[model samples]
Target: MMKKKLWSLGIFIILLSIIVYWFYFSKPTSFPTNEQLVAEMNRVFPEATASIIQDTIPIDERHVLAPFISKGDDYGLSYWVWKNHKWKVASIDTKGKPMLWKLNKSDPSSFYFVWNIDPKDQISSIHFYLIRDRGYQITRGIQHYNPKVQMGKRVSLQEKSYGLMQLSGTWVTFMNAYNKVESAKQYPERNMFFGWIPYDQKDMGIFPENSVNGASYSNGEIGLEYLMIVDKGQIEIPR
Candidate 1:
């Protein structure tokens, strides 16, 4: 009986040690420096040829969004995540168009839109939207209609050229409820999408002379949802 007790204690100690290492010791204590980040970018993606490390914006303790300027004068974005005991480049985009990063795919509150637009574009403001198209369907003698959803939040970009925006509470709540419905699973094509429109001081949508025209590279390791450039006619006008 004493021998069996000792064996059990030994197994318990081994399990405890593993848990401790995974929770605390396995992760890096600090984030990588800007120089190190630049090197890592070039190392992982040689085509990126990142010239300057612009900013390191922390999404949470474990995730970071770093925007950089490439040798080709392209404003770019890279996503970092501390996983498997090291900071890894989760995704990289050579063109810095506004993108939705879903930190937790299951949680809408954790979703954020990040961008590093070139200052020369003169983007005075941006309108971000969460849109779902109206739908009609008939199945087994049942008729169903889904109304259009078009929620928007506008942000002033006159102060800065690069930034991040979290999903509003209304957006989060609506997405959560929408995700639970059967239609969301059945007709995934009708699901909501994120989009944006940049406007000048005159409130007219800026033609994508520089912002949207670019060739980009991505490894597709993370969920970086595309933000469609919305047209004025696509949005509803208030009476």
Candidate 2:
């Protein structure tokens, strides 16, 4: 009986050691390079060649966000993760745009994200050309995207909700090319985007018809539009 007990303990120790080694001591292969990544992406998209906007955005040592544009110019987002001791393509958002990444959820009461999205326009890019100020002022500016220079501001209406439903949630804002007060380096007046007035509900009506209005709009979570939301966690967007 004593010998048998010792043998059983030895087997258990061996299994535990293997697990520890596999998880920590044994690392997976190196991260894929741009060329290797493009090849990997070709598996799903036959005509895939290069990334869409930029190269892969690293979330951490184990996770990466890759956006690709097909030879035909169609765009897509692919999420890769290190799993089972190998790099695996966990999932892909074929029609995802970077708008969701720009969405802000800092203040829920003052801002609410609209749960309505035009699925047909999923991969569409946002261009703000018309600035609708709170005073019903409107201005159009020519925005030149130099690719090298990062400029512009993004606003959102929501407290960073952890649920995945926010992925499809899009707060309505005027699509403008450039902000009028670029010198100030602040977001255009409250009228530039449509979000809730934050306070004095009755004042919402005082705004002119030409200005953009904002506030979160939803008929509860029961509809085709409220399918996926954004997660606040890094490399972990709940859907």
Candidate 3:
């Protein structure tokens, strides 16, 4: 009886060890280095100007991860999940916003990244990818958002929420371009390009128009004949 009990305990320990190794030890890491990312961008898109938009560069994972939904749950709204090259990554894209990364709860890693995106009217698609690795597991994912230019009715400019930083000259430059479009009957010649904006005003980046007769219309509307030119490059914009 004693021998049988010892044998049973030994088998249980072996099974537990196997489970631990499979879940934690045998995994890949998919995180990309700053250099690797830059090289990838250059390889993929060599034609357009690919400067590192320092402000929009998501190098840290702090703001990328969502805050706790409660005490027990840790995972946020994750969209892409994968493992590659010994790295683990998880990402979520809310359309216009940056692709958020998921970090480890126990050990937080510092990430250094560079942005090499160009703004163009011909672009039909935009994609952002995030990667992370922990617990000997690697994961990665990409989120793609398409930008389509269409006509809409012009409307009056209405007062909406704006970030204090947006008032500090970042968006001021674009205001001039907006005036130029508003004054002219022709379509706005210049288009705005950027990767990130002040988190506060990131959602309300669209241009509003008000006619001389007190009627208002949003840009691209049928009744409205106007165009918006974003002047900032580092700020990400909503379509």
**Top-TM-score candidate index:** 1
For all candidates in order, the CA lDDT equals 0.84, 0.38, 0.27
Backbone clashes, candidate 2: 22
In model 2, where is the ten-residue run with the lowest total lDDT?
Answer: 160-169
| Prediction 1 global C-alpha lDDT | 0.84
**lDDT tens string, model 3, 63-152?**
222111111211111111222222222321111122212223212121111111111112222222111111122236554332332211
lDDT of 1 by residue, 163-219 (tens): 899999999999888888845575665467889999988988886565565555555
List per-candidate RMSD values in Å: 2.9, 18.5, 22.4
TM-score of each: 0.87, 0.37, 0.26
- Cα error, residue 146 of model 3, in Å, equals 41
Report the lDDT of model 3 for residue 113. 17
Stretches of candidate 3 exceeding 4 Å from the true structure = 29-89, 94-96, 99-102, 105-118, 121-239
lDDT (tens digit, per residue) of candidate 2 on 1-239: 99999999999999999998887657666878867777766665444344543456555576556655545444455556676677766544443332232222332222212221122322111211112322222347644332221112233313311111222122222122233344255553333322222111222212222111211212222111111222212112135
What is the clash tally of candidate 1? 0
Instruction: Give the residue spans of candidate 1 off by over 4 A.
Output: 1-16, 23-28, 139-141, 183-189, 213-220
Off by over 4 Å in 2: 4-8, 20-29, 44-53, 99-239
TM accuracy, model 3:
0.26
